[model samples]
Target chain A: MRVGVVTFPGTLDDVDAQRAARVAGHEVVALWHGDHDLQGVDAVILPGGFSYGDYLRAGAISRFAPIMTEVIAGAQAGLPVLGICNGFQILVEAHLLPGGLLRNDHRKFICRDQTLRIENTSTAWTGAFAQGQEIVVPLKNGEGQYVADAETVARLEGDGRVVARYVDVNPNGSVNDIAGISNERGNVVGLMPHPEHAVEALTGAGTDGLGFFTSLAGVLA
Target chain B: MPKPEILDPQGKAVLGALPRLGFTGVTDVRQGKRFEIEVPEVTEAVLAEIAKMADSLLANTVIENYTVRVEQDA
Candidate 1:
């Protein structure tokens, strides 16, 4: 499968995401933010970064990038889209996902190896893991707290749209300790942690994040 | 100024007990840090530069957003 990683001007994690995709046996396609075409890639990743220098708001400007128009259309057609960190913010800003991220309750930039429980494994991006599985991935962000109306939260819970929950500690005071979520159809997933940064065991963060990329192989097969 | 997390365990413990100490109507409270910067003169260019500094370093635009105000010291 060809997986495209979109690189906005200030995107910092596109390379890492591309490397992870290659390691997972997918042809990695580098997509630019201004391009309206997806190059026929089977899946896409909106990698992390301070896109547009987070000028107006984190991911606020990037959500309207020309490439997102194509991404939105592809995602609607059942193409998988995985958004990490800033990319997740773009997804929310675009209304492709529910909820918004706020500053950490503690009000500081936090960086740590965060533990997360895989809450829903049936999504196209998480099918490689068993539900309730515990995995550790690096999380570094200042505004990682997630919030939404109580009704939306309840609905997400009721529909099994929540894909991951913080374990051990709620790193950013996300409502209900949510660490990640998927769209109702499960083709789109967004999380604040840098799963690509945790894909290699030699890197010391463990390779638990590989499941995200490898899960696509199963879906494509 | 950015609000810091209440990290001092003892401080948090004391604040946590304030509501029980008859401090009624205290909905929520968190500790924070305060900082002051002195600018030689305030100008549109200078203020814009400060905003850039805040965006680039003083705040992590990803998680923390900032508000800036200018006041002349008497």
Candidate 2:
């Protein structure tokens, strides 16, 4: 399986994501935000960053990028797409995911080793984790707070679409302590944390995030 | 949707500073941006368009809410 990591302007984690995919036994493809082509990759990863310098909202301008027309089209057609951090914001701005991310309630940028529990391991991006498994990943962001109407939050929980939940502390006051969520089909998942950063012990903590990439390999197989 | 009242730190800062300048008995303050959108005319259709822009772009919709006010140029 070839996992394409999209490189957007100011994208900080595309290379790291590419390496994570490669280490998980999948070929890595470098996808560009300005290109309309997806390069025929089986899956796409929208890496973390301050895309377009967070102008007009975090993911606002990036959604209109040429690559997204194809990315959104392919995602709607059931292609597996994982959005991490700013990529998660892009997903919501692109209307590929419901709800929106807001500034942290306390109005501060936070960076730390964060613990998250697997709430729904059925998504294409999270299948490698056991149900309710706790994992630690590095989380860094300013506008990582996830928010939505009460009904939408209830529906996501009712349908078991929440893929991950923050454990110990609510890092950014995300509703329901949701660290991540998946689309109805589970092919599209978005999370506001730096999972790719935690893929290796040398760079980050224990390789708990390797499972996200490996899960895609499992899905493609 | 009615936006839940979350304390606006920026707005509070302005509220605190105003009293030092001799303005008295101010109960509250919620400072926000005001944009004068230039439209051809103040029609319901144009006001609706401005409202849409406010909802989708100008306002964050999560922490901050916005209201669109249209006034015709004399």
Residues A61-157 of candidate 1 have per-residue lDDT tens digits of: 8887999999998988899999999999888877789987876767678999999999999998999999899999999998788877778899999
True contacts kept of each: 0.00, 0.11
lDDT, candidate 2, residue A50?
91
Error of 2 at B48 (Å): 6.0
Cα lDDT tens digits, model 2, B1-74, are 22555545445666788999999899877666667789777888888888788776666565457777666688
Each candidate's root-mean-square deviation in Å? 8.0, 3.1
RMSD of 1: 8.0
Q: Which docking band does candidate 2 fall into?
A: acceptable
The superposed Cα distance between candidate 1 and the true structure at residue A172, in angstroms, equals 0.6
Candidates' DockQ values? 0.05, 0.28
Candidate 2 per-residue lDDT over residues A1-221, each given as its tens digit: 99899999989999999999998989999999999999999999999999999986798888889999999999999999999999999999888988888777666899999999999988999999999999999999998889888888899999999999999999888989999999999999999977788888898877998899999966867
Q: What's the true lDDT of residue A164 in model 1?
A: 93
Q: Note the chain A TM-score of all models in turn.
A: 0.98, 0.99
Worst 10 residues of 2 chain A by lDDT: A99-108
